[model samples]
Target: MNSFEKDWRFTRNSGKGFESAELDDSSWEKIDIPHDWAIAGPFSPDHDSEVIVDDPIEHTRKVFSHPGCTGGLPHVGKGFYRKHFELNLKPEQSARVEFDGIMSHAEVYCNGRYVGGRPYGYSSFALDLTPFVKNGTNLLAVSAENPPGASRWYPGAGIYRHARLIVAGRIHIAYCGIRVRTEGNRVTVRTEIENPSARKVVLTTRLIDPDGNEIASCQTSGDRLFHCEFIPDEVRRWQPGNPVLYKIVSILGDERHETGFGFRDLTFDSRKGFFINGIPMKFQGVCLHHDLGLAGAAVDRDITRHRLNQLASIGCNAIRTAHNPPDPELLDLCDELGFLVICEAFDEWKRPKTPRGYNLLFEEWSERDLRDMIRRDANHPSVIMWSIGNEIPEQYYPEGPEMTRRLCGICHEEDPSRPVTAGLNNVDDSITGGLFDAIDVKGFNYKPYIYARYHAAFPDAPIYSSESASTVSSRGEYSDRLFEESGRKDNLQVDSFDLCCADSATIPDHEFKGQDDNPFVMGEFVWTGFDYLGEPTPYHREWVRSSFFGIFDLCGIPKDRAWLYRSRWSKQPTLHLMPHWNWQGFEGKEIPVQCYSSFKTVELFVNGISMGSRTRNPKKLLGAYRHVWSRVPYSPGELKAVALDEKGKALAETSVFTAGAPEQLQIDCERCGNMVFAVVSVTDRNGNLCPHASERIDIESNGKILAVDAGDPGSAKPFPLPYVNAFHGKCAAWIRNPGKTLILAKAVLNGKTVQTEITAEA
Candidate 1:
């Protein structure tokens, strides 16, 4: 597998004999396996060229006229990946191939024979390779077809996740077939094994904690399925901010394998919000897409860990994989980091959100897709709920209720330990009235106005905010107007501190109050936690191609709005100052100074002079809390904010100064194994980040550059290169095996080159 991932023959153009055993692939280019052929493309506006006609399949989707044309990137075609490997297994042993995820449609071939295939990209599937394999060298081929206009956002092409090959005895534990549950001190495990020989076998399962202590052991005899129960002396339950995991090793006829599991109980009520282990807890959640900025859809362990750490720093305790299932590594990270997850299955069900979406194949493939998702992720402890669909238009149709019920039933039958839910956006009570009976939990998307009415209609239903807060803003841009609707072309979004909604349908300021006052409303998952690659909102022809709904920008830099959530969710005393003190046009006139803090009193100062102090007024804020000094005179100096407790003691203090012209290039690199992530930032002479700097920098490295990313979804610049224009004063570049002993990065900004080195270890 290591050598197969290192080098592979890839061709974007398909042919009839490409999957044959004797076909010649010598002319194909050598590339890596976890690659997005579409992402590494010659990007242009012409690529977003999907047209909607009057036909049944084409008429259901919407048209676009934005800069990127709404396709996001040039990943709308077919490609092939062929690799050679040696499989030396006994005739009685079996071999199989497992794919975490593929793009849209994927087919597999071994040696020369055709194997099984999977159509949906988000659902993980497997194929048996024993029948088609030889004892020694064998050729493996895979073809991926991703037609344009199939999705509303950018879905990367080809195999964008981890792939592995498993070889075991005739009877062995199946992939992702173990489910564990804990009730007080008792641990129950259900294991399913595959036995093509139809022979009964004895299976032994043992539970080992992180400290290498064996807590329980049991054995069972079965040909296909078995259940084992045991009791431990002490139990530590998994909860928010405290994640405890255990390893389960299964032995079936000499076959050995292990998986990570945890013990926790999740319950919900209309009157008590959410509970974990009998303690009430709020869901501080954020919706996240699968793409990792410039890294595309490929799953990198360090990259995912870095993103989760950033979200955790901002006080987020849960994540909602918006509209689709996520990479398996993401769920693993949530388990290790103590984040609850709502694993979603599909974005569209029977109704097309685009010209060619999942609806075109829903009837034939939905059941298999949903079942596969549950089987693959049922073992993860971080998953508390399985979301069937998101804002499906079926909610308004006559058959919507039955469709929802069928989907929920499938989820429950597959794994009943977790409840099933769907995101309903229909604001009409009559239309969505029957959906409550189909699901155990009701997820409302962008319909906060109907909370009271729906609660009265169904007193037993548990309510959750599947998606909320579509506030739009660009990093470092400021406008004095409280709200702006003209996010049209040529209008860059307001400053990171100012939030504006697209229409009057939602006032984010008022929604927070509604959630806090109603016990029936458990918690809200914001529309986005980070800016994703596509579906540019408040879009205009002249604007960039990505979204502006994230609390943090694409580069993982926190916008001022992040402090708004941190003030309310974080337990630590926090104080933050926004809109750096650099306003050239309005230097003397009154400037609006705002501070997001949890403390009761906040004092404002400008250049060592005290402006005034004010206490937080609950009646003044509708959304999150913030202290506003609306009429402070601006100057070219330092601005500071200090937060004090009720006893007048200082809790925390923060300061922001007017940055000078960009003078230096700073590099912060994190090395995980052979991978290196070099975060490049433009800074002033004093080392403070210059948010306004947009300098074109030339990067020359002594090692391999994986991808150079700036988090600007609108930019058509080629990545995996040596040069990029910093967007909002920041960009990132991923390097592989910089050096066996040392890695060097040299950046040239404004004709000055600075070099940095990282001491690497094996």
Candidate 2:
């Protein structure tokens, strides 16, 4: 296998003969694979698309109040890419090219000849290039386009995932053809082959444990598909927090295929959540979108790992790839990191949600896409369930149940080991309409109040909150007055202290109580684990673009809500205070103090004086997990919280200090291939980031400055620039390394400059 990721020329143009093998593409932008051109956006709402205006009365699924729901990025257009390579192969050997993912309708060509195409943007596909291959130099071309208003959130344009070239003999194994299933003590391995000469193939399978010891071996001979079984003496089960893995090395002819797998006995009970390896456990999951903040839809390994690690730190063990399928690397990471996964397929079915949504392509593409997703991910032990569709409007239609049945049947046909589920918004209508009985597990989306009602009515149906806790907040944002809490007057900063959620969704407290009260119900996957681009609720104006639903901000910074979750979900003791004690204008005013702690009681102190000690009242809303001193007077110095056990002994403590004026610039950086991001924020004298600092930061870099983003979704000040005023005291610059040398980036604020340098290896 050869990576087709590097040395590609790209252009945002459309015309015939561009795919010609002899065409000169020297003027096109030099780039690499796993690229998203849309993230370097103008973010102009003025782009040629029908904009949706804010509607005050109605709040629906994927339908935000405003028309700028898609992050107002330039994702609605066509882009072309071309690559050249030399290849020489024997007559018996053929070749194929694989694309991990594309944004939308993609047409691939080799040597100026059209080979294949896939309409679904998220599905991974491979095209046979043997038909168009030459003995020497060959040219490959691909065109990708994002239709106007194709998605509700940011679905980036171009090839946003890695592409590869695979060459194999005529008797080689089929693509994603190896399947592993564990039953009792026996394990079965099925292999599909592509033999043109009708050769009787000998398949040798070896099972290796995590410690790399070959424990068992099996052999089979067949002209068609081969099946091998092995019953190891000791079985290692894979579970969250303890992912015991094993590998299968299969040999057929000269082809050697290795796969990683784990043996697990998983069963779901109506009265007792899910039992894995005979141990019952609740799923503390979170719904994650494909975008990687400033990286857009491009798959970055480090950024993706960082985001997942943040969720894992707060005790999130399961993941739901919201609305669509995910990159294959994500599943590989989940397997290594011990995260239970729900590999979702579609966001819509036959019902249309947008102008050119997946509804139009459902008939021709849904089945094939669903099959490919299962085939590619079925081997991963982390995958416990397959989600068919999410919040689809078909739930309200008369024929919804039949479609659900059809999809469920396809899932069982493809892989029967794991159960299939769908995120249902209308639980009542789904149950009464027979939609509930069509699938294996019912995923309740944002209706915490009906947890008891639905369970009581359908006693045997296993249920879990597919999406909940959409509470919105901006990190480091707070105000004593309710009027200033709105984002407009505060640099688009929503109040962290005054938490609000959507009409369909509830806060963390509501979902917390629901999950805590109903032991039978499987735990909830929060609406989002991180704040994402677009779908800004409550403040869905044209200027505002990114949602505030995440426990962590867009840059992966933890918000105050992260503390609340850590207090509830984590086993390690946690004590976190909220809302920085920096009220200048509202001195002596009543400031509500809040803290989330694992201990039984917590004492609040202000300016070295004890306010009071408080304990949670389970019967009261938000009082079950949070300690509050709502009437504490604000006097800027320090506010602290000391967690005490039932014996009144202080076990843990945390403090929040009032920040001074911005005095310096602090910078952190991370590299993604040739691109490096400089995250810059202004800090006070005590080295704390001043939340209100909107200082204009000018950056001079030895390398080329590609783009600047302050995690502000509304700011449309052209991303391909070098200077920007900080938003929430923070902004980042994307710098491209020109050569293998030290690249210094200097940030100047108030005529004071601070610099950081990195050496790019050759």
For model 2, the superposed segments whose C-alpha errors exceed 4 Å read: 48-67, 481-491, 667-681, 698-708, 717-724, 731-751, 754-762
In model 1, the clashing pairs are 477-495, 478-495, 509-622, 509-623
Error of 2 at 437 (Å): 0.9
Candidate 2 residue-wise lDDT, 260-370, digit = tens = 988888898988899888988888889999987765788876567767877888988999999898898898889888899999999999898887989999988888999
Computed on alpha carbons, the lDDT of every model, listed in order, comes to 0.77, 0.81
Q: Considering every candidate listed, which one attains the maximal TM-score?
A: 2
Give the C-alpha miss distance for residue 220 in model 2, angstroms: 2.0
Q: RMSD for all candidates, in order, please.
A: 3.4, 3.1
The residue-by-residue lDDT of candidate 1 on 1-762, one tens digit each, is: 345476778998756777887888888988876777777656665665445332222235455455453435678878888988898988679999888888868989998679988888877888888889999889989998887778777788888887888888767788777777667767788888888987889999999987778878888887898898878777788887889988888888778878787878888888778999888888889999887766777777777888788788878899999878888889999999999999999999898877678998899999988888888888888999999898887877778888888998999898877899888777463245576578888888877767888888777889988888778777666654344453433454544554465443344555676686676788888878887767566653443556777887766666777888887788877787776676778878877777878788988889989888889666776323677777788888889988877887877889988888777777877675566767778888898777766677665556577778666656767776666877767777777773553445455555676655554454
Error of 2 at 422 (Å): 0.6
Best by lDDT: 2
TM-score of 1: 0.93
